[model samples]
Structure formats: structure tokens, C-alpha cells
Target chain A: MIKARVTVTLKNGVLDPQGKAIEGALGSLGFEDVGQVRQGKVFDLELDSADPGTAKQQITAMCEKLLANTVIEDYAVELL
Target chain B: MIKARVTVTLKNGVLDPQGKAIEGALGSLGFEDVGQVRQGKVFDLELDSADPGTAKQQITAMCEKLLANTVIEDYAVELL
Candidate 1:
């Protein structure tokens, strides 16, 4: 089995209201030094595939098809 | 400015309905050999502090106080 980690993050210049809210909350909680707080998603997947090369390609396809919204988000997959 | 990345994931044995849904979706989409899928959160933060040590401490506090639910989720902070 192969293990993979995928990170999906908003594109630069995209407005992230959730992240903004968190930043505000952090400030209210007395964490003043925090500047930009951008929130993203992470997925840890276990694949039954044997080859790492094929696994990465398959995972990338998964991202493009369902895991990520390619319109506004970017995804990166790391095999572990 | 110091940059840090924080990842928050559900603890083992915790029920993740969303992850389960994604797993099922993958199966339906013909992505066979996919085993377990777990979902998590990632935060990219830019701190105004110049010291990495202090920045990590502050970010950790942010995770403990607001970013993660200690009862169900575990968080890791990395300075980048």
C-alpha cells in the first residue's frame, strides 16, 4: 500500500472569508502578531497501488475530478 | 516576517463522515485500490514577529486556543 497526502489551498488573490474570520478570531483571542491567515484542506489517502509513479498520476486525476475545485483552488499531492 | 504552516487532523478512531463520503465517491468513480481516506485542515500563516522561536510558540497557542479542537483533533505546526 502507498500513502499520500494532498493539500488544497485557495489561489492567490481569491478572497477567503473563512480564513478572514479565523484571523479576526485569533486577533480577538490576543494573538496579535499573526498577519495573513489562509486556510486550506488536507487529505491523507492510502492507496493499494504498488508503483509510486502511477499512484501520483491517479491521485492527481482524483484531485481534478472530485477532490479539488480547480476553478479557485490549487492542489498538491505528496507521496509518503 | 516569519512564515509557518499548521496542519490539523482528526485523531485516530474518530469518525469522519466526510472522509468516508470521499472514499465512497472515489470507489464509484472507478478509482479502485484506494483504501482509507482522512481529511484535515491546513493553515498558512504569516507572522509579524522576527523570531522563529516566539512565532512557533504563538502559533501553537493559536492552534490550542482556536484552530483545533483538542478533544478530537491533533495539530502540528511547522516553521517554513
Candidate 2:
């Protein structure tokens, strides 16, 4: 089996409310040093296929279609 | 500024409904090769501090206190 780790994060210039909330929470907790916090998504996928190349291709398609909103987010895939 | 990337994932054996939902979605979409899909959270933090060591220490504390549910999730911190 092949394992793929995908990280989907918002592109620069996008406003992230969750991240802003986190930053506010941190500041309230006295972690004033924290500047900006951007929250993202991670997916660890286990594939039945053994070929890394095919797994990557399929997973990339999966990200494009459903896992990530390509209009505002970018995804990176790592084969493990 | 220092950037700290924190990845929070569910512990082994924990049931992830969101992940399961994604799996089902993939299967319905004809990606039958995908077996297990685990969803997690990623935090991209920008800190005012220049020292990596201090930034890591603070970020670790953040993870323990608020970023992660230590009982069911494991978090890793990377200073970049």
C-alpha cells in the first residue's frame, strides 16, 4: 500500500477567520508574540495501490475535485 | 519573524467521522483504491520572535494548551 500526505492551506492574502480567532485566543492567553495564525487541513491517505506515481496522480485529482477549494487554497502532496 | 508549522492528527485507533465521510465520498466518486482517509489540522503560525528555540517552546505550549486535544490527538511542531 502507498501512503500519501496532503496539506491544503489558504493562499496568501486570504482572510482566515478561524486563524484570527486562534490568534485572539492566544493573545488572551498571554502569548502576545504570536503574530498571525493560519489554519489549514491535512489528509493522510492509505491507498491500496503500491505505485507511488499512480497514487499521487489519483490523490491530486481527488484534491482538485473535492479535498481542496482550488480557487482560494493550494494543496501539496507527499508520498510516504 | 519565525514560522512554526503545527500538525495535529488523531491518535491511532480513534474514530474520525470526517475522514470516514471523505472515504465514502471518494468511493462514491469511483476512487475505490483509497482505503483509509484521516483528516487533521494544520496551523501555520507567524511569530515576532527571531529565535527558533523560543518560538518552538511557545508553540509547543500553545499546542498543549489550546491547539490540540492532547487526550485524543498528537501534535508535531516544525520551525521553519
Candidate 3:
């Protein structure tokens, strides 16, 4: 089996309220050195195929179709 | 400035309803070759510190205190 790790994060210039909340929480906890905090999503996928190429292709298609909002977010896929 | 990327994922034997939903969604979309699907959280943090060690230490503390549950999830921090 081949495993793929996909990270989907908001594109630059996008507003992230969750991230802002985290940053505020960190600040309240006395982590003044902390700067920007952006929250994203990760997907760990197990594929029945051993071929990395095929797995990557399928995972990419999944990301494009459902996993990520391509209009405001970007996704990176890593085959493991 | 130093940046840290933290990934928090469910440990083995833990139930992930979100992942199961994704798996079912994929199967319905004709991606039967896809097997297990685990969903995780990602944090992109920008720190004002230049020292990698200090940034890592603080980020680890952040993970332990607020970022991860630690009871059912494991978190990995990567400095970028």
C-alpha cells in the first residue's frame, strides 16, 4: 500500500478567523514572540496501490474535486 | 523570523469519524482504490525569534498546552 499526505492551506491574503483566534490565545498565554498563525487541514490517505505515481494522481484528483477549495486554498501532496 | 509547522493527528486505534466520512465519500466518487483516510490539523506559526532551539521549545510547549489533545492525538513540529 502507498500512503499520501496532503496539506491544504489558505492562500495568501485570505482571512483566517480560526488562526486569528489561536494567535490571540497564544498571546494571552504569554507567547508574545509568536507572530502570524495560520490553521490548515491535513489528510493522511492509504491507497491500495503500490505505485506512487498512481496514488499521487488519484489523491490530486481527490483534492481538486472535494478535499480542498482551490479558489481560496492551495494543496500539496506528498507520497510516503 | 522562524516558522514552525505543527501537524496533529489521531493515534492508532482511535476512532476518526471525519476520516470515515471521507472514505465513504471517496468510495461514492468511484475512488475505491483509496483505503483508510485520516484527517489531521495543521498549524503554521511565525515566531519573532531567530533561534531555532528557542522557537522549537516554545512551539512544543504550545502544542502540549493547547494545540493538541495529547491523549488521543500525537503532534509533530517542523521548523521551516
| Candidate 3: regions farther than 4 A off | none
Candidate 3 lDDT tens digits, A1-80: 99889999999999999999999999999999999999999999999997888889999999998899999999999987
Worst 10 residues of 3 chain A by lDDT: A50-59
Itemize residue pairs with steric clashes in candidate 2. none
Instruction: State the lDDT at A5 in candidate 3.
Output: 96
Question: Which clashing pairs does model 3 show?
Answer: none
Q: Write the per-residue lDDT of candidate 1 for residues B16-53, one digit (tens) a residue.
A: 99999999999999999899999999999999999999
For model 1, the superposed segments whose C-alpha errors exceed 4 Å read none
RMSD of every prediction: 0.5, 0.6, 0.6
**TM-scores of the candidates in the order shown:** 0.99, 0.98, 0.99
- What is the C-alpha DockQ of each candidate? 0.96, 0.94, 0.95
Model 3's CAPRI class is high
Question: What C-alpha lDDT, on a 0 to 100 scale, does residue A28 get in candidate 3?
Answer: 98
